[model samples]
Target: MTTATTASDDVRLSAREAAERHLRALVGRDDAVLREDQWAAIEALAVDRRRALVVQRTGWGKSAVYFVATKLLREGGAGPTVIVSPLLALMRNQIAAAERAGIRAVTINSTNIDQWQPIHDQIHAGEVDVLLVSPERLNNPGFRDEVLPRLAATCGLLVVDEAHCISDWGHDFRPDYRRLRTLLAELPTGIPVLATTATANQRVTDDVAEQLGVHADGTSDAAVLVQRGTLDRESLRLGVVQLKTPEQRLAWLADHLAEQPGSGIVYCLTVAATQEVAGYLRDRGLEVAAYSGQTEADERHALEQALVEGRVKALVATSALGMGFDATLGFVINLGAPSSPVAYYQQVGRAGRGTDDATVVLLPQAEDRDIWAYFASLGFPREEQVRETLAALAESDRPLSTATLETRVELGRNRLESMLKVLDVDGAVQRVQGGWVSTGRPWTYDAERYARVAEAREREQQAMLGYLRTTECRMRYLREQLDDVGPDGRAADCGRCDNCGGVTLSSAVSDASVAEAGQRLSRPGVVLEPRRMWPTALGNLGLDLKGKIAAGAGPGRTVARLTDLGHGQALRQLFREDTPDGPVPPGLAQAVMDVMKDWSSQWSSRPDAIVVVESATRPTLVNDLAEGLSRVMQVPVVGTWAIRDPSVPPRAGASNSAQRVAAVRRRGGLDADVPPGATVLLVDDQVATGWTLTVAAVAIREAGAGAVLPLALATQG
Candidate 1:
């Protein structure tokens, strides 16, 4: 790509020359040559008024784009540059860089609330050139009521960093992002707005535009410069291992650590998991640290320092480690499957920062299959959920606590929170003093009008899920999802995915070849319930199962009984209701009650089990039930289902059975064929949904599985 050249190429030095001059003047180095692509991006910024989104991989000098823009704005006598950044660390880094370049930049955040008054005065006094503030800081009343208004009067330019936060589809959502639209509204018109992110899909692009009040029609005078660069790191080798046991996974990690020594990340799903794994790794003689949301700010800072200073070889962390830190981490091991591809991409993107070859190993626990299945089944939040959440926020008076907001909206808390935060970053809602409040009016378009747009967003999410479930061309899948067209006119087939190994496995089915190759696997049991049978079951059982589960419940103590389990008899007698046919199984209703109580106990004890469902049915139903249960129970449902093949000799409804099993496997991650000695269970909405049960039984038998039990809501058969 040729470097971008200004219209006045003769008078205006090329972007490269400008960059070199600035670098030489600032760092006393003239050898710094701007990359052709970086120069193109910088040059485009000079004249382009359309909001531009610069997407460059890490270490690609993304900051230089802004640096060049800053210089241009300053030279042109544009108003003082105001940067909205997500992280205090990033703000500090930028401020330091600017200071080193002899530019007067000031950062406002929590730590320097006292210094902010002077800084604010200086900004209005025209002493400060660049002002860096966190999204949260912008939401402050003082800033909003006093400082921001003053700054707006003398506006230079506004830049939003990590701008993907504006997309509800982005992995990391910040509530402050929603206020940007209001902030922009207050700014003088014609001031350039530049949004930068290393990762953003079309969904992100639309969200950014929407947040900035840019229309989808592309008629806005504001320039929309999108530079989609190659995120491919040929030096990075991606490997995924499916492990049945935690021990085996840890062993593999240890072996990998020993083989390749350098800075690395062992990413876990939870804070406790990070601590446990970090401790274990440390015990195994590996120098390690832990990072998670629960880690104290001081402690996290120390840990980061340790990593940067080479005092630690590895850090076991939750997703919290990926965003702000700028270390050249060598490897990243996913101890569990990330909730989404965006997460996986962000986590893995942290590695190979220095351009040298690195590795990203995904050690997906067998249990992770269910997590992936749950994600696949639900796909992404329905457009209704996103719309509803945004609508609720738009209607609210002040920022409401998540609990308070949940009572008003019909969505799972976590899912809702994630969505709200995304909208928040997108400038739909602002985080107020104690809670989240609407930044502006609700979307005014009729639901029917945006239905297609919503569907497109859903398709994009599904595409990402498909990439996760894919066994072929992981890189190709990623490139396709990003809509990246490489030079070859074909999707770049990253040589690292399982498919490129000459191994072809259907994502719809587990990679049996790999599974059978002695890679330990964890195959969840199938439950005898409609994949989405939670609502009906909850209603029929006359129990708020979600409530109990959230209170705390243990898996071992929770038992669901059918009509054959005897409790059904008592339930029918107590309620004087007719039994649904067949033999009223002994202890069924009582077993279900016990399961409900136990589930509650488990939830209280371990939040991870807070969202447990008694049955897993069809994909759509499963998604509905899970969403309902998550909202009602205030916990995310770990969906369970049974799997069976429809193509057996004695098969009745063979095709339906095969389709159900396929669907369940595609969504819930359980298979009929479990390894020998594996403890398995059959879960279903009703025993009449026996196709999945039969398949599960046959496959378990074939695999020499041990102790397969049936867990069902009803048995009409």
Candidate 2:
């Protein structure tokens, strides 16, 4: 025992000296020093070989601690460190930092599949010091079964970056992150593990710490030593601007973006808003571009660089820019409020990192609540759906692809994919190249647990509402929401925010700006691309549908998208279930007529007649629209297609294109007696899959119609 203690003390002294050297190199300064807590974490990992959790705020040098410890461990003849990073952007940043310290780091992710072999070779040669991978890669069947076991046996250190994602209690819970437990259980004895995050609250911190499991002393109660610090940003001056309408918000943003701090981000709640805002800003002569999930990866990288170099004034973005993004951004302007205070804080943290003073402003709008509810609806699957999926996979003789299973399931493709990921983590199923197969493991549907999470989400949203209504210091309210009441002796008010500092931000917008913004928002019409081909996979379900649709719905137009910030609100209310179906509203009728007149050139000829696609839920709305168009054009209302079987359950709202087409076929075909080679206009209340219009147009074309023109008030999901 005495000999072991002496040896450990010697290792500790050497580790500290090595840590300081690496820290200096890492920071690119000879006199640089590590924080007391940073050094403590390094000691725990490099000397004691203990598990640790560091929950410090951003810009707190969490990555430095890991890199320094890794250098020490590798020098002591330990294998390379393995880090599970949450984002590609984060990995990019980490790799550059590691190289600065003269530590060799390599990453394996989807983007560099071809280079993975060379990276693996380097690790086998002991030429690599660190290996970073995203959580999703851990579930790769080949890697999990073969390569991961070898890494587990020889890896010197295991690091989980943005580790809060591991816990469902976390603001962002990724199913793939939860799979880390399997990796944890398989690690060789005496290997130190580290988990780091800047945004986890007390609940998330404790949860992640427990998962890290007992320290090097063989202590079992808490496996990791968790070190937390205050979530205060002294440089951030937080404020809020209340806008009565979307136009007002856009106007304010246009009027003030140039006057705000340096290059920054303008966050929108949706992709549509980003496009709209970015367009308006560009029209205002501000250099800006839309950045969202739809932006190409290469362009996104360029945009990130642009912001870093202050080449672009701002990049209007969505939550896609919420995490993983690293910038010394000078300001952050939120066009809409996030659903939770934690999410808000996480986003704002991206700014004020490099400067002494940066602006963080929130422009809250009532529409934000509707957007929140739309996202909230996509929560966990029901027990029936889970059991159905499991039973389908278990009963199959061979692996069934997602496309094949779609025929037997009711959920949409995206939702099904998300559920499969969760189930894959739970060991209920396995995803192979051909498709997925059941693991034959028994699984329980945790209804109560999911319900608790739902309730928690509701509570968080309410807290956000509370934040918007609070009169105290804006920064303090946010900190308290994260349960970050700082040190016991810390000041209650941050004194940097609008409230505590007694500074008032104006909501004034110049008349010229308001008119410009109003015209931009009210500008109508969205190109509706016709369905060129039937959605693939219909034949897999035994339907004779594949390849280019020989007969297709042509290019069309929608007055607006349901997600549009302009006139979509009125269109949505008109289609709501509570709003009884009736004749077209006079204003909507006028708008439709105006749009048609503007699109007259697109049509080959005027309509000889108007044909309405039947709607069980809104029969009156469709019929009224058809009749109104006919009356305005002085054409006859030819006929309406009726659903063949009232007993058949509702199918108009089917999720996928293929299924939606099948449902329309089952409902009934078009019922029209048409003269050969006569032009007819087809009208529907809304276009979703566009399958309805395609099917109707096919029937009409087969009946010898010269052209079928499709029109609708809105395009929806």
TM-score of each: 0.61, 0.94
lDDT of 2 by residue, 149-185 (tens): 9998899999999898898888888878867877786
Taking the tens digit of each residue's C-alpha lDDT, what string does model 1 give over 1-717? 112223665544754566667655554566766677776666655544345667766667676667666776677777678888886657756777777767788888877778977987887777887888888766665677677787766766678888887664675656567667666666555566677776666677667755664533422433456677876656566666665555556656655575553787888866645665676667668898888877877787788878877788888888777765677777777888775566677778788776466777777654454444444443335677667666666776666766555544545455566556555545566555677878774543245634654465456556645665677777666655654556665577777656677322222212433333122211111223323221212322233322221111112321222221123223323222243333223344334444544444423232321121223223342244334434544644333433233232222322232233333333332323344454443333344445445434434445554434434444432
TM-score, candidate number 1 = 0.61
| Model 2, global lDDT | 0.83
TM-score of 2: 0.94
Question: Could you tell me the lDDT of residue 112 within candidate 1?
Answer: 79
Q: How large is the C-alpha RMSD of every model relative to the true structure?
A: 14.5, 2.9
Worst 10 residues of 1 by lDDT: 549-558
Q: Of the candidates shown, which would achieve the greatest lDDT relative to the real structure? A: 2
lDDT of 1 at 532: 22
